[model samples]
Target: MRSKRIVILTEGHTNPITAKTAWAVLRYRGGDVVALFDTTQAGKTAGELMNVGGDIPIIGSLDEVAEPDALLIGIAPMGGKLPTEWKSIIVSAIERGMTIISGLHDFLSNDKDLVAAAEQHGVELVDIRKNNERDVSNRLDLREDCLRIHTVGHDCSIGKMVTSVELTNELKRQGQDAKFVATGQTGIMIEGDGCPVDCVVSDFVNGSIEKQILANQHHDILVIEGQASLAHPRYSAVTAGLLHGCLPHGMILVFEAGRKTVSGMPHIPLTPLPKLIQAYENLAALHMPSKVIGLAMNGRLLTPEQAEDERKRVQDETGLVVCDVFRDGSEPLAAAVMNLRAEIFGTPVAS
Candidate 1:
């Protein structure tokens, strides 16, 4: 059977957080992308603008697609609320016999108009975030066979997902069986499976992650994609819950270069990289003999000189291998993880 054709809708917002959901589809599910709908980035091809979309068209609206099997609501808005403007577009897609898939807190399946339109058109409405509370039966304990490398970050949007994906691919390239366990809405969208911890209620978030870890037990290494920072007030519960939920063997600390405060909140200053890394290590040590093995920095917004300087500074501070995953690739970071693997499992990750 053929994969369903999907078109991501980004609309006017293209900031990293909002665009991240579409980024996952582009990076991991590009084969299914029929087109992208982001008027802000309409003219450029998906590959030119996104992390991973190869030569796909970017249209202004759903009117451009003759037909699509599904329309993925591709923005994790400020509050995960579906934009008021998006309702009309969603209804139109449903009317056109397109199933709607969303990972938003505002459950599209529960919205009366959306449900009615989907039923009327004989299409399906899938809210990946909603209706999954029962699947989490238990918070299983960590596995002894699989080495879980949880990617924690200094702040939200600090390259956790990108680093996790890149490192997993790098390990696979070296013939080390690696798996990515996604935890966010975008990661779930990209992997086609994962527990959206932010959407999961507090009591069940850990149970949900525990369930994912138990299900994916085939790989040698599990590169679990991390979530919000423990420093982030609004989302610290999720960050801490996911961090402890997976019960990592080690961690890769990710940080954005030049970010002084938690993304938008300037009132709270960011702790130094060494301090933040130590905090995660201390937290993980509570459950296991875990420490941060490497560093991943998002240096895209920084100048080359600034990026290099920060990398060197962080290396000095943490005494760990640091790599700019986007500009320099994940080899340095991957090597660090591989070294840890060798120490634990007595194996080399190379040809």
Candidate 2:
């Protein structure tokens, strides 16, 4: 019988640890492991492949690697910090229509171009961050958690607070093992002191940084909260690519008063401005595909004029399917995002 093949896209050294680990795991699970590298100076590369021995095959680049059941990406302990080194291997794999699992840490910085390249090729980006969710001390409060958890910059909001919390709880309940960390006003919780967890969270701080950590570490899922959509559209898409291993199913735009919505690209909603002025160049505002639809949620308080203008701005900028929340019913923002994906891809929304 043919062995199930799994490809590991990584630099030279650190791959051995993973290569051997994967070989053992796959064998136990009834599969195989394959290693591919463009170049490796670090002694780690040879050691790992050798450690895994004959079972795991080592290849040169994405082009040389055969199709596998899945692709696993990681940073080589001895690998250079730059993500670009692994670009050819990553892009080539995705272009060939292979399933991918990536390390978020290096992926965001080193493989950024490859990330974009992967999306263009319609490859699904999977986050290994959840594997580390348990790494977070449950005893540690949110504030200290944020300190330990590195963040990028701070600008933008994550969206509705109630919705964000609920989603966090749901992820936990589902045993998806994702970490729900925050920034901005609602940033991580510290001690018994009170902090504005409701302020528009910053994606630069939490979402990007956390996702990278989760991916680099190879965790399954990592949930970054307080990131507002439209704030940093590219980073948002990048985050989506890092975490979910694909472009965000779609983007969400929300309006809620006194709520201080966190905004970024992808899942995060933008700031709550009365008039969300939008214009379009050749590309979508957030580098989203033309196929993604834009939707509006009234938050049940917008005037007719306000709603009309919001609708117009979204329609003009995205050229996507737009739906009014008031008309669409009060589905939670996360659920709404799933619904939009279903409508576009013709797949049933995973309830």
The per-model lDDT (C-alpha) reads 0.81, 0.38
Task: Summarize candidate 1's per-residue lDDT along 1-351 as a digit string, tens digits.
Answer: 233689888787644455788877777778888988877777777777665676788887777776688888877776788989888888878888888888889899879999988888999888877745555445345566788889998988778988998899999898888999988777877776787888888887777788888888677899999888877877888888888778888899888888888777889898787778878878877877898888898897799999999899988888888889889999987888877878888875445
Q: How many clashing residue pairs appear in each of the predictions shown?
A: 0, 49
Total backbone clashes of candidate 1, pairs 3 or more residues apart or in separate chains: 0
Candidate 2 per-residue lDDT, tens place, 1-351, comes to 122466655555333333332332332332355544425532233334544334344555555555565566534222213355565665666777676664343333234775686678776665332122212212212221111111111223212332333444554565534344432222221111112221113333223443334333342333333233333544454333222221233333444422343422335544323233232111232543422223333333466677666666756655544345444432343344445435554664344
After TM-score superposition, what is the CA distance of residue 176 in candidate 1 from its true location, in Å? 1.2
Cand. 2 TM to true fold: 0.31
Measured on C-alpha atoms, candidate 2 has an lDDT of: 0.38
Candidate 2 wrong stretches, greater than 4 Å: 1-4, 14-30, 35-48, 63-65, 74-82, 107-112, 130-351
Lowest lDDT 10-mer window, candidate 1? 131-140
